[model samples]
Target: MATFALIHGAGDAGWYWHLVEAELRGRGHDTVAPDLPCDDDAAGLVEYADAVVRAVGDRTGNLVVVGQSLGGFTAPLVCERVPATLLVLVAPMIPAPGEAVTDYFANTGYDEEPGGDTIAVFYQDVPPALAAAAVEHGRHQSEARLGEPSPLTTWPGVPTRVVLGRDDRLFPPQYLRRVTHDRLGITPDEIDSGHTPALSRPRELAALLDSYVEAVARV
Candidate 1:
């Protein structure tokens, strides 16, 4: 079984991945979803990666590192420190080496895109009760990490994959297509959901993750 080291995005803790974790565990895989120090102004990208590495502790074999949204920047750094079998990005903000997190939106033209309603953009497909809880669970994201350049000097050598939600408003599908292509030379696999697919479509997300393990085995 593969161990999925699931990393959540900005302002969110490991709680963001709770449902997806359940689905992955049900499929008989071990999973680690750590609460990042996103609220701590002192915590930067290195600290972010440190939390995940420590959470992983020394388990070996078939590590699949999955990152969502801003977690994208931290995931690649984890691969550099772990024997990750594959790196999966779910609606991620793919980063360039040395690019600061704050610069990401403007550098990628995300700032120019028209914004949408908060509910419609991020939690449109999520269950109402759960969505409310998610909002309540959010923490204050700090600028310490956002202001620093991503310390990934180079992308890790592990095989990589990108997944994008077709109905995503926060990061529109068309926009992500260009970002993924320009940054990673990849065409993301599309899913029928909004930005937070783990909460909105956990089963389908789990299945897609499982398929990645199968694909790696084939290689």
Candidate 2:
């Protein structure tokens, strides 16, 4: 069985992959999702990458590293350190040179005030149930970490998969389309879910992970 390292977005713990993790394990794959030090600005990109590397333990056999949201920006760095078989980005925070996480909030018209709840970054047409869940799981992020550029330019030259949420509001569809297609030079698989697919669409998301592992074995 191949190993998969799952990373969650801002404010969310490793539990983000609860559903997907269970499904993948049932399918005979090993999965590890570590809780990132979300509240710590003391640890920057390298620290985040280190956390992921530790989660994988020894880099034996085929390993796939999946990063969601903010974890996306840091996943490539982990691949740089670990011998991952493939890198999968799910509705992640795409990084650029000299760009900060604050840039997204500034340009994307997001405000951090709503009766103590921060603005919802992704999912525009959210159902009431999903909206409430999203808010609870969402957490405020440190500008220092995101503002710092990703240490590595790109992930290893493995089979990389960019899975886009068809209805993600946090990162604009146009930008995700461009980065996944043009910037990264990878045609991503499409998922008809909001930003938090792991929470809402676990089986569908798990299937995507299974597909990636299977495809890599063939390669």
Candidate 3:
């Protein structure tokens, strides 16, 4: 069995991964989903990483750290403190040394803002009921989190994989592909969902994660 530590993106809590968590536990794997302090004024990347590390305390297993969206930034920091078997990024924001999240967006050429419908941009493929609930329950994210410089000097030495949503409007497939290649020297695998796959396509996401773990075990 493997342990999956799921880190959510900005403006989201661990509840965002509830579906994915259910799917993973159903497959007999251990899972931890930490609620990041994205809305708190005092919390930044370091605090975010600390929450994830605390959730992962003393777990002995094949540990995998999975990050989604802005979580891409926080997950690597956790890998620096913990022993992870692999790091899986889901539509992540790849940061350079001392780069802030705001700078990363501009650097990545994501020039267009959402045309007023977050559901269209983020949850196009999700079920309507779930999407509506998510929109209603979404929390306000702190802007301070975006300006903090990422503390990583280099990518963590653990094995890594990037997964992109083929229909993601927020971060298009081609853009993520280019960034992944330029930054991580790898290509991302694609799924048939939008930005928030854990809500829209949890089963598929879980299967892909399990497959990655199996593939890594063989090596």
Candidate 4:
């Protein structure tokens, strides 16, 4: 049985993955969604990765590390340390080799106000009224982390899965598809939900992942 480590996106916390984690557990899979120290600050990647590694503890079982949005930057690092069975990217913000998260957002087309609760609203998928709720709960990330580029010389050869939010207002589905298919050479599983599938569409997201896990076992 493989353990699942879920890393959340920016302007968000481990709370976001609660539903999906429960669902995975229900299916008899081990899981953990750690709270990264990324709040109002931009959070450096090294610190974020270290936090993930720490939370993973000494569990030497087969692992499935799922990185959501900003979490994509840290997931690969976990893959580097542990014996990862899979690296799953949920509409990930994949930083190129030696490229930082800042690079991805700079050209990401969304407007970045860069201050207080205002920044949270810009990245949230919930309605305007609920977006504010995320601000308080969201952890303050370190700006230094955003500047630290992902340290992957090459893609992890281990099995990888990517889940795309079809109606993702943040990372357009088509764009994500292009990258996963044409660029990465992997046909990612698709979800017709928003950027926050674990929150917005937990059932669908979990069902899809359940199927993939089964599929992987047979391979």
User: Model 2 clash pairs?
Assistant: 100-147, 101-146, 121-170, 122-170, 123-169
Which number leads on lDDT?
1
Candidate 2 per-residue lDDT over residues 1-219, each given as its tens digit: 888899888877786687789999999999888888776878777787788888899855788989998887778788877788888999876565445666754544444332322335453445567567667765556656666655666446666788888777655566677666655776778888867788667889998889878877787
lDDT of each: 0.92, 0.74, 0.90, 0.74
The estimated TM-scores of all candidates read: 0.97, 0.83, 0.97, 0.83
Residue 96, candidate 4: how far off, in angstroms? 1.9
lDDT of 3 by residue, 95-199 (tens): 887888888888877765656488888888999999998887678889876787889888999999999999888888888999999999998999998999999
- Residues 1-219, candidate 1, lDDT per residue (tens digit)? 999999999998899999988999999999999999999989999999999999998865889999999999999999999999999999999999999999999899885454666566689899999988888888999986588888999999999999999998888899999999999997899999999999999999999999999999999
Ranked by lDDT, top first: 1, 3, 2, 4
Q: What 10-residue stretch in candidate 2 is worst by lDDT?
A: 110-119
Clashes of 4: 13
lDDT of 3: 0.90
lDDT of 4 at 21: 85
lDDT accuracy of residue 185 in candidate 1: 91
Off by over 4 Å in 3: none
User: Per-residue lDDT tens digits of candidate 4, residues 1-219?
Assistant: 667888998757887787888888888888888888785354467667777888888765767889998898888888887778778899787656777677765544445233434434233555554455556667655565566567766777778889988767666777777667754787878877767788667778878877767777899
Better of 1 and 4 by TM-score: 1
